[model samples]
Target: MNSKVINEIKIKDGRVLTLVEGDITERNVDVIVNPANSYLQHGGGVASTIVRKEGNIIQEESDKIGFVQVGSSTITSSGILPCKSIIHTVGPRMGEGNENEKLSKAINSCLGLCLRKGFESISIPAISSGIFGFPNDKCAKILVNETISFLKNLEDSSAGIKLVEFCILGKDTLQAFQYEFEKSKPEF
Candidate 1:
């Protein structure tokens, strides 16, 4: 983690959390990361949205990566998605994950790729809380915490990212990450 150059730290800067309720599939960000399965193949929910929008090339590119694991990820071009790139991050499966640790890593993987891709801005929907059924609060906590943890200490602080927005679809979720991210380090 770089930790020096600030890209999108909400608490550190003067900005409050940007929680928007809208369709993530159509948002125009540098990259719209997907909460994908290890197979990288699209199935349902957000996964299906990426596949349906990006065309068949997404699955074709994903096939080259083989099966990824929880907390890890892979990337493929968005064949038809509105964004320039599609980062496929495999979030932890419901109950099968290591509670907090693995989820943290998963969040990092997504953020790390954003930097690696030279993208300073990105958008992510709720990961693992839909069909994966991991519970919304826990998912938001892991995502916000791990994202803050990584961005705060990133060595590649020059990732050029100015914003990392979470385009949440519902109010309950918007409140969750906004709350956790507002907490002090040991407040949890």
Candidate 2:
């Protein structure tokens, strides 16, 4: 079965922010962002799905990295997955102090890593919205804003990161992201 794209926004710089309803691990982008824990363990949630589908090599590379600070991100080989890399970002737990800020940092960290690696496209899920318990609406807002700002700040899109896709699973989350995307007015 093919995943349907629910929305597509064209950045003023000519890049795209796409919203898709599907399994994120299946996306064939240059990079896939994983909402991981500080320990870099893939025991459950989106992390587990990627590790299981991609192969143990992903986890092995993660083990080598050891730990990632909350709101920080690290990259690992994509293992058997189609993407070139997996960016493991550790977002904040809802009750944690400054949850909003932490989530923003986590996302920015992922984008920065993508720019550094010169990845032309990247796919991300709603980080911290699952077991980490961040509000879905809030997750959507921050993600959309951060991505738009990231693209806007680029000197001239010379870094090569062109597409940023939010791959949401389930109907409710997809709706939340789509709604937020609609409400947000991109700067152009």
Candidate 3:
């Protein structure tokens, strides 16, 4: 559990970046996550964004991996995305009692992989909170808290991850992170 709180979460000059939902194609980040099917195929939704930015290789290489279990993950090069990599993480679909656990894994995989790969910065989206149906506010609370806890546990080398952005796709999602972040702000 990373309890490290470097600073308050803000918009500009902040470590995290939140954008409008559904506009992934326009926002920029070091490495964007592709909410993919277990089969690693790129279809509609986030899949389409990856293809539009990283080229079809997003699907091709992913195909080689051939289906990840729900709540597990894999990685591939960004190819054409502004970022250096594309982490393929499978999120849970609409259901009760499954979203949080699955989201935890999805998030952990992305951060762990980036750290293992020696990346110092990364960007992510709320997992399982979109078309699959996890509520944005709930997912944001868990994701931010968990991610913060995870990062705080790392060494400086391990802690080199100074950036963990959330390119929000809508007002609700953006507000979720913002609201949660404020609650976690350090008391001066």
Estimated TM-score for each candidate: 0.82, 0.96, 0.82
- Backbone clashes per model, in order? 11, 0, 11
Q: Candidate 1, residues 1-188: lDDT per residue as tens digits?
A: 11121122463332222444566767777788888888887888888877886678888888888899888877788877678888888877777847567677777888888887888667888888777877788887777766665655655444356676677766676667666655623311
Cα lDDT, model 1, residue 70 = 85
Estimate, for each residue in 33-69, the C-alpha lDDT of model 2 and write its tens digit: 9999999999999999999898899999999999999
Best by lDDT: 2
Over the full model, what C-alpha lDDT does candidate 2 score relative to the true structure?
0.90
Model 1 poorest 10 in a row by lDDT? 1-10
List per-prediction Cα lDDT, in the order shown. Answer: 0.71, 0.90, 0.69
| Candidate scoring better on TM-score of 1 and 2 | 2
User: Which is superior by lDDT, 2 or 3?
Assistant: 2
Query: Which portions of model 3 show Cα errors greater than 4 Å?
Result: 1-28, 157-159
Off by over 4 Å in 2: 185-188
Model 2, residue pairs in steric clash: none
lDDT of 3 by residue, 1-188 (tens): 11222235532223342333444444455567777777777876777776976667777888788879887778888786667788888888867457788888888887887778777666677777777788888888877877777665665632356677665666677778778877865332
Worst 10 residues of 3 by lDDT: 1-10
Predict model 3's lDDT versus the native: 0.69
